[model samples]
Target chain A: MIKVDNISMRFNLGIEKNFSMKQFVVDLFSPSKRKEKKKKKVNNEFWALKNVSFEVKRGEVMGFVGTNGAGKSTLLKIVAGVMKPTEGKVSVGGNICPMIELGAGFDSELTARENVFLNGAVMGYSRDFLQSKYDEIVDFAELADFMEVPVKNFSSGMIARLAFSIATIVEPEILIVDEILSVGDAAFQKKSEAKMRSMISGGTTVLYVSHSAASIKALCDRVVWIDHGHVKMIGDAKDVCNEYLRSLGLPVEGEGNGA
Target chain B: MIKRVWLNFKKYSFLLKQLVARDFKIKYKRSVLGVLWSVLYPVLMMIVMSIVFSNVFKFTTEGVSYLAYLLSGLVMFNYFSEATNLSMSSVVGNFSLLNKIYIPKYIFPLSKCLVTAINFALTLIPLYVVIIIESFSYPDMKLSLLHLVLPYDYICLFMFTLGVGLILSAVTVFVRDMLYIYGIIVLIWTYLTPIMYDITIISNPILQSLMKLNPLYLYINFARQIILHGWMPTPAYFAACGGSALIVLLIGMAVFKMNQDKFIYYV
Candidate 1:
C-alpha cells in the first residue's frame, strides 16, 4: 500500500545553471537578480506537482497516463521514494522495487555480470540470493553469452533487457514501473509484458506509467490521468483511457468497431 | 544503540564489499602494473619529496632517518587526501544512479574510503621497505613489534578521513565548487601538516599547538610514535586517537543524515 498526500514538487529554474559554488557566491552578492527573483512571483521556480493526493491499496495495478512533461515521471519517482515531494508526505507499507529507468544503476565500465550483482545489491538483494538467481537473470535477458562483456559495449536494448531481468527476478511486494513494458524487441517486449502480468496477477501492488493506451487499459485496474501537473481525471482504466484519447483527438478503443 | 548499529553494519556488509571491489577493480582494470602501483606510488612520492626536502630544506629528523618520518607522514596524509577526494566525488559521481533508485547514500563515500584504505595498506609494504633499507644507515630506524599495532592508528585515520569525506561528499552535492576548492585545501593542508619538516622547528607555541588540532596530524603522530620511536603510545595518545576519530565520525554521520534526505532533490 502507498499513500501520497498533498504532494507537490518545485524545481528552481534559476539554480540549475548556477550549480557551481563560484556562481552561487556571485549570485549571493548580486542583489539585482535576487531582488528581481523575489519581486516576480514564482521566484524562477515551477511546481511539477500540486496537491496531488492518491492512494493505492495492496494488490492494485494502477496506471498513470499523460503527455510529455505532464509530471507522470515525477509522480512515479515520488511514489518510488527516489524523490521526496516538496511539501507533502508519502507513506509506503511495503518494500518498493522501482524500475524508474531501466538499467539506470549499471556502471557501463563494469561487465554485464558485475552490473547484475551491483544493481541487485542496490535493490537490497543479498549476495547469496543474486548468486543463486544469477543464471536465471542471464537466461531471461538472453545475454547469457554476453555476461562477461562490459555493459558499455552492449546495445541499448541488451542493457535494458538485462536491467528488466534483474528487476523482475524477485516478485517485489510493491513495484513501480515507468513505461518499461515497451522495452526491447517485439518478442522481448511480449515476454516482459507477460512477466509483468504474472507479477500483477500474483498479488503484487503495481504503480505503472505508460503512454500506450492499450497496455494501460489491458493491465491497470484504475488509471490516473495527469495533465500539467494536476489530476486531470481519475476513474476506471478504460474510461479514463478513452477520455485521455479523446482529449488527444485519437480514436477511443472499441468506440466504432464494438460500440 | 550500538547493537542496532552493528546489525545495520552486518546488513550492509555485502554491499560495502561490492562497492569497494568495484572501485578497487576499476582502479587497476586493464593496467599492467595493477595493484603494484599502490606500493610504488608512495615510495616514488617519498623519493621526490625526500630529495627536495633533504637537499633544499635541510631539516633535522630528531632521531629516526628522514625517510622513515617522511614515508609515514606521506602515506597517512596521502590516504586522507585521496580517500576524502574520492569520497567527495562518490555521491555527485553517482547522482544519476542515485536519482534512479534508493540506496543508503553514505555507502558510496564509505566504500571509497575503504578502497583507498586498501591502497594505504598496499603502500605499507613499500613504507616498510623504505624503513628497512634506511635502517642500514640509521640503526634506530629498525622495525619493532610496536609497528604491528600500526593498524590501530590506521583505523583511527580511516575513521577520521571517512568522517571528513562524508561531510565533503554531502556538501559537494549542493556546492559543486567544493570539487575544485577541496583540491586547493588539500594542497594547503599538506603543507600545513609537518609531513616534511620536524615539528620542533615551528618554534612558536601557538602555531605548534594549532598544528596539533589538525586530526590528520594526530593520526600521523600516533603512527610515527609507534614505528619510529619503537615504543607503545601513551594512554593519552590512544584516547586522543580514538576520541577524535569517534567524535568526527559522529559529527559526519549527523551532518550526512541531516542532509541526505535533501540530497535527492538538489542533485
Candidate 2:
C-alpha cells in the first residue's frame, strides 16, 4: 500500500535583492504624465500542492489525471524516493520502480549494450541479474544489429526504445510512470502498453500520470482528477474522465454541452 | 554494517576496474609513447636535476647516487600529490552518477585513490630498476638494506595519501576554488615533507620537534630508513602515522556525510 497525507510544496519566485529591474523600470517610467501612483505589492510565495491526501492499495492501477502544472510529477517523485515531501508523510510498502525520466542516465560516449548494463545497475540491479536477462533486454529493444555502436549515434526514437525496454524489464512491487507513453511511434506505444498490461495482470501496483483521457481510460482501473494541485474527483476511470472533460467544457459521453 | 560495506565493495569493485582501464587508456590515447610516457616524466626530471645539481654546484649524493635518492622520493611523493590533487575534483566531475545514485559518496574519491595506486605501481618498475643499478655501481649495497627490509614505510605512505585525499576531496565540494588552492598546497607540502632534502637539514631543536608532528615527514623518514638506511621504523613512529591517518579518515568521512546531501542542490 502507498499513502500520502497533507503534502504541500511552496516555491519562492524572485531575485535575491531589494528590487527587481522590471519593478525599478516600472517605478521610473509612469504610463501617464498626470500624477504619481501608489506602488503595487508583489506576491513571492507560490504553492504547487496544497494538503493533498490519497491512498493506493496493493495491485491497483491508479491513473493520475491532472492539468498542466498540477504537481503530478512532484507527487510521483516523492513517492518514488527521489524527492522528499515538504509538509506530509508518504509511506510506501514496497520497492518502487521509477520510470520518471527514461534515457536520463545513459552516457553518450558508451555503446548501447554497455549503457544497458550500466543503466540497469544504476536502477539497483546487480550485474548477475543483468547478465541473466541480457539477451531479453537487447531483443526487446530490437537493437541487436546496432548494440555495439555508441548511443550518441542513435536517433531519438531509438534511444526512447532502449530506455523503455530497460525500464519495463525490471520487476518491482510498485511502478511509477510519468508521461512515458507519449513518446515513440504508434507501434512502440502499443508495445509499451502491452508491457504495462502484463505488469497489471501480474498484480503489480502502478501509478501512471498522464493528461490524455483516452489512455487513462484504456489502462487504469481507477482515475483521479486533479486541478490546481488538489484532487477534484476520485472514482472509476470513465466517470472521473467524464467529469474532467466536462470541466474543460468538452462534451461528455451521452451529454452534449455547447460551448 | 560490515555487510553494507561489503555490498559497496562489490558494487565499486567493478566501477573501479572500469575507471582504471579508462584512465590508463585516456591518459595515453593520443600520445605516441603510450605507457612509456609514465617512465619519461620521472626520467626527464632525474636527468635535469642530476645535471643541474651534480655538474653546476658539485652537490653530490654523499656516496649514494643522486639519481637513486631523488627517484626514490619522487616515486612516493608523486603518488601522494597526484592522488590528493585528482580527488579534489573527482566528486564534482562525477556529478552525473553522484546526482542520480544514493551509494556512498566516498566511492568517487576512493576510486581516484585506486587509480593513483595503479599508476604508482606502474612507476615503481623504474624505481626498482634504478635501485638495482645504483646498488651494483656502489658495490657495498645489500639487498635487505632499504625498502626490501623496511616495507612498513611504503605502507605508511599509502595510508597517509589515502587520508589526505579523503580530506581534500570533501573540502573541494564547498569551495569551488579549492582545486587551485590544493595545487598550491601540494607544492608547498613537497618542500616541507623532506621529499627533496633530508629532514636532518633543519638543525634547530624547535624545528626538529615541529617536523616530528608533520605526518609527511614521518612518512618520508619511514621511506628513507628502509630504502637509504636499511632499517625498520620505531614502533612509536609507525603508530603515530597510522593513528593520524585513521583520525583523518574518520573526520573526512564525517564531513563528507554531512555535506553529501546538499551536493545535488549545489551542483
Candidate 3:
C-alpha cells in the first residue's frame, strides 16, 4: 500500500538569460545589482506538483494519465523514493521496483550478461537470486545469442527488452513504471503486456504513468487524470478516462462523436 | 545515526560488492598489460625517483637503499592519490544512476575507494618482493614481523582517503570545477608531503611538526618505519594516524549527509 499526502514539489528556475555560478557570485557582492536582478526575475518558483493526494491499495492497478509536463513522471519518481516532495509526506509499504528509465543503470562497456547482474544488483536483488533467474531473464528478453555482446552494441529495442526483463524478474509488491511499455516492437509489446497482466494477477500493486489512454483503460482499475499538476478527476478508469478525453475535445469511445 | 548507517550498510553490502567489481572490471577490461600495470607503475616511479634524487640531488636514505625507502613512500602515497582522485568524481560520474535509482548516495564514492584499495593490495606483492631482495643485499635491512603493523597503517590511510573522497565527491556534484582544482591541489600536496625527500632535512622543530600534521605523512612515515627500517612504530604514531582518520571520516559523513539530498538538484 502507498499513501501520498498533499505532496508538492518546487523548483527554482534561474531567470537570468545566461545565469552561471560565476555571475551569481558577482551579483552577490553587489547588493544593488542583486536587487535589480531579483525584480526582473518572474515566476521563478515552478510548482511541479501541487497538493497531489492519492492512495493505492495492496493489489490495485492505478494509472496516471496526463499530457506532457503534467507532473506524472515527478509524482512517479516521488513514489519510487528517487525524489523527495517539498511539502508533504509519503508512506510506502513493501519493496518497490521502479522501471523509470530503460537501461539507465547499464554500463555500455559491459556485456549483456554482466549488465543483467549489474542492473539486478542496483534494484537490490541478491546475486544468488539473479543467478537462479538468469536463464529466465535471458529467455524472456530473447537475447540468448547476444548475452556476451556489450550492451552498447545492442539495438535500442534489445536494450529496452533487457531492462524490462531484469526489472520484472521478481514479483514485486509495488511496480512503478514510467513510459516503459511504449518501447520495442509489436510482438515484444504484446509479450510484456501479458507479463504485466500476470504480475497484476499475482497481487502486485502497480502505479503506472503513460500518455496512452487506451492502455490506461485496458490495464488500470482506477484512473487519476492530472492537469497542470492538479488532479482533475479520480475514479473508475472508464469514467475518468472518458472525461479526460472529453476535456481534450477528443471523441469518446462508442459515442460516435467524431470530427 | 550510527544504527541507521549500520542497517543501510547491511542492506547495501551486495550492491557495494558489485559496484567494486564493476569498477575493477572496467579498469582492466581492454588493457593489454592488465593488472601488471599496478605493479609496474610504482616500480617505474621508484626507479625514476631513485635515479634523480640519489645521483643528481645526492639525497641519502639514512642507511637503507634510497630505492627501498622511496618505494615504501610511493606505494602509500600513490594509493592515497588514486583512491581520492577516482572517488572525487564518483558521484558526478554516476549522475545517471543517481537520477534513476534510490540507493544510498555514498555507495558510489565508497565503492571507488574500495576498488583502489584492492589495486593497492595487488601492488603490494611487488613491493614486498623488492623489500625481500633489498634485505638480502643490505645486511642492516631485515624484514621483521613488526611489518604486520603495515596492514593497520593501510586501514588508517584508507579511512582518511575515504573521508576526503566523500567530501570531494559530494562537492564536485555542484561545482564541476572542483575536478580541476582538486588535480592542482593533489599535485601541490604530493610535493608538500615528504614523498620524495627525507623529513630530517628540516632541522626546525616547528616546521617538522607542521609536516607531521599532514595525515599522509604520518601513515607514510609509520609505514617506512615498519617496512624499511624493520622497527615498530610508537603507539603515539598509531594514535595520530588513526585519530586523524576518525576525525576526517566523521566530518566527511556529516558533510555528505547534509549535502546528499540536494545532490539530485545540483547534478
| Chain B: TM-scores of all predictions | 0.95, 0.89, 0.96
Residue range A56-160, candidate 2, lDDT tens digits: 999999999888888887678667765555688889998777888887557677788878876776566667777888889888888899899888899999999
Kindly report which residue pairs in candidate 1 clash with one another: none
Q: Determine which window of 10 residues in candidate 1 chain A has minimal summed lDDT.
A: A15-24
Q: Lowest summed-lDDT stretch of 10 residues in model 3 chain A?
A: A11-20
* RMSD (CA, Å), each prediction: 2.5, 6.0, 2.0
Q: Give the poorly placed runs of model 3, Cα more than 4 Å off.
A: A15-33, A40-42, A256-259, B1-4
Per-residue error at A6 for model 2, in Å? 4.7
Arrange candidates by TM-score, descending: 3, 1, 2
Listed models, DockQ each? 0.58, 0.17, 0.58
Superior candidate under lDDT, 2 versus 3: 3
Q: How accurate locally is residue B45 in candidate 1, as Cα lDDT from 0 to 100?
A: 90
Tens digit per residue, CA lDDT, model 1, A137-198:
99999998999999999999998899999999987899998888888999999999999999
Candidate 2, residue B142: lDDT: 42
Q: Is 1 or 2 the stronger prediction by TM-score?
A: 1
